[model samples]
Target: MTLRIHFTGEDLARTHIAPQPDVLWETMLSLYRLRRREQTLVFGEWKKTALGRVPGSVRMLTTLVPVRGYTVDFLTPRAEPGSVAGGMEALRRTTGERLRGDMAELLARHPGKRLPGWAERLAAGCPDALDALVGAVDGYFHACLSPYWPHVRAQVDRERARRARLLSAGGWEAVFSTLHPSARWSFPVLELSYPADHDIHLGGRGLLLQPSFFCRQTPITLRDPHLPPILVYPIEHDLDWARGQAPDRRTTLTGLLGATRTRVLETLAEGDCTTTELARRLGVPPSTASRQATTLREAGLVNSHRLGQAVLHTITDLGVAVLGGRWSGLIA
Candidate 1:
């Protein structure tokens, strides 16, 4: 089945990519990965580590976020972007009517399922019940999500950078077309492969493209069409992302590209930047930064595009490979 998202010109114009991963969204989606045993190649190591010390929140979250179904939107209230504390505060502030409605809708989807007493109290807007829920989720996040968040944030940030490059080179159309293999851009409608068939018409509310580390397979959005639309999709992962430590072989890269060029590549890996910004960071003349960036571009290790007065440079896949010490000696 496909999830068809209809977009008007205003909607397209207003569409934007999130700067970072949403802590609440990723935390919620990770539960799906945890409950399911699939994707062992991608999530296996992290799962082993996370499950080693099971917090009570694990059991509670698993119940609410069923392995394959809808979860209450209140649990993932639109917080201050990527802040966990902000998300918890937003969650706590959820009105009783909204919580009850969201929880009821979630249970309706599951049919026979029933909330526990605490969950029931949560639906009734009981302060203590909400506090317990928040504490449990916070504990789970500290134990599981916090440990590997740097990796998660890096992956999401890289994906956001890639999308920005694509947007710079092409437009919203290009972004939608290349969003993922599972998605298709047909004029104003973006079609996504989803578990069920549905349509979300964005009546000028726009959409937020959220890159997630734990979200896998297909993209997902809120069940309620009235809510602010957000499409949470999994970004491509580094095989070593979930592994404990990232490889550090800057000395080897320095030997190959020299110290200045090596530093340029490393900086670009962090994000796309202009030659001026690069020069500022490198504390060199604009001409020098331009020359080094040109060399990296010539070697097929970087991608640069012009934007008004500044030239934007991004690290290509090969650049990343070379910088990360996973590159072969040959450039071509």
Candidate 2:
């Protein structure tokens, strides 16, 4: 079956890339991924590490987000630009009407389906139930994704850089065509491989393109078409990240590149960044970041490209060799 998303010219014009990964969306989607043993190369180690670490609170919460089909939207707020704390705050403020409506719709999808006691209570919009939901989400995120967050953010950033290149080359249509093997860009509609066939009309609301590290296989969207439109797709992974955090090689890098320069390289290695982004990350002045990026680019440790008004800087393959991961383990 195909999920057809119809877009208007206004929709296309207003469509925007999410500036950062949506924390709650990833958290909610991961519940499905954690239940099954799939994609061993990408998720095996992470699942193994998280299998035992999942807290009881989250385990109870998982009943609402089953292994497949129809998860409640109230559990995951809008993929706004902010921190996890911000997302949790949004969940905490979910109105009683919305809580009742979302859960009723979810249960309606599988008539006569019985949820756990707490989950049923959640459907009733009990205040305590919302509290429990927030707690469980916090526990799940901390246990499963917190440690690997930097790596997760890095993967999302890598996708952003790649999409930026595609946009620079061929515009929005190119982005939709190559978004994933399952997706096809055909004129006014974006078709996706999905379990169910349905139509989501943009109605000029536009769409938010959100890249997720934990999203696997197929892309997903909110079941309620009345809400703001969002497309959450899995991003390409770096197999090296599955090995867990390596021993710090900062000492070695500092010896070769000095403290600030070494930090610059490390930051770029994590994700491609504009000079302003690099500066913001490093807490340094823009001019200082630019100069350092120039030095690194001149030394062939980084590549700088003019994408629009910003110079996007990415670590070169040689720089990858120096930091070490995909090419080989830490530099000797």
Candidate 3:
């Protein structure tokens, strides 16, 4: 299928909601500020004072990072295919029965129209074990972010009302009439979501509101910044690129693994280094360093070019993108 990608400038200009590029950048920065704060609370304070107080903060941090990384990885466009396929695969592997049940339910009576090709494939692939099949699908989605339909719907409703107020507030036309043209084109805000009954038509541009994070509810930093230098997108894009591969490479697990592997690749960007060198610098074990390197090589993060008796690793183009945050969801 041909996919229409709306780049930064053209999209915003067509919408006519022109705000200074600096203002837009600041808005993204604010979101990042919020995300950092949230991460601090979840990974730092809450874990230390609450959950970690009982279970152990280090373990909590370790577990949460992978989960957060998984969700972050799943949200980006590049990694989306993996999100779909890996989700299906994981459902098959983990909750085959539940997957089957959900699929049967979808086939019998879903809230929306007939299941899409991908969704149907997920259900029909494993015949008798409907529940398992369905569960995997359900779990894959739930694992990313709980479908906050209620939350998203509420936020969208509020935004719609607020927008109406803005339009009717009289300054609306004036704001657009003498607006800075660059402001409109330079910063595009694309909404990604799982397919829904309602679609948002911004000016004439159709936003791909895929099922992912509900921008309204997510802490602002999670929002996609129209431009880079202020926001990164590569990691997520890499994951998307990876997902577009054969089904074997899909999954949040792969995304998580890929992202972690990406980081290891970056460390090697300066030059090839031994696993021991990486472990010491990265503060991990020799085993972890070695395993991460192996994974990265497999995922095409880094390459092992033999140097004498020892093998040295260096980042590839993929590794550069990941380290630089060209793919938003992958590493960050």
Which candidate gets the maximum TM-score versus the true structure?
A: 1
| Model 3: lDDT to the true structure | 0.36
- What digit string (tens of lDDT, one per residue) describes model 2 on residues 1-332? 88899999999998987877888988887777788778887688888888889998886666678777788887777835638898899889998888888888878887787878887787778889889889889888998888888777766866777777657655787678767788888879999998899789999999998988888888888888888898888876655575644434444877878788888998887777889999999999999999999998898888776654777777754576566644223221
- List model 1 lDDT by residue over 1-332, tens digit each: 99999999999888999987898888899888887978998788888898886696667677678888888887777889778898789878888998799889988999999778888898899999888888878888999899788777777877787888778756886678666677788878999899889889999989999988889889888888888898888776655556644355656877888989988987887767889999999899999999999999999888776555667787765576565643311111
Q: What is the C-alpha lDDT of each candidate?
A: 0.81, 0.79, 0.36
For each candidate in turn, the TM-score is: 0.77, 0.75, 0.22
lDDT of 2 at 48: 88
Error of 2 at 119 (Å): 2.3
Model 2 segments more than 4 A misplaced: 245-332
Ranking of predictions according to lDDT: 1, 2, 3
Which 10 successive residues of model 1 have the least lDDT summed? 323-332
Cα lDDT over the full model 1: 0.81
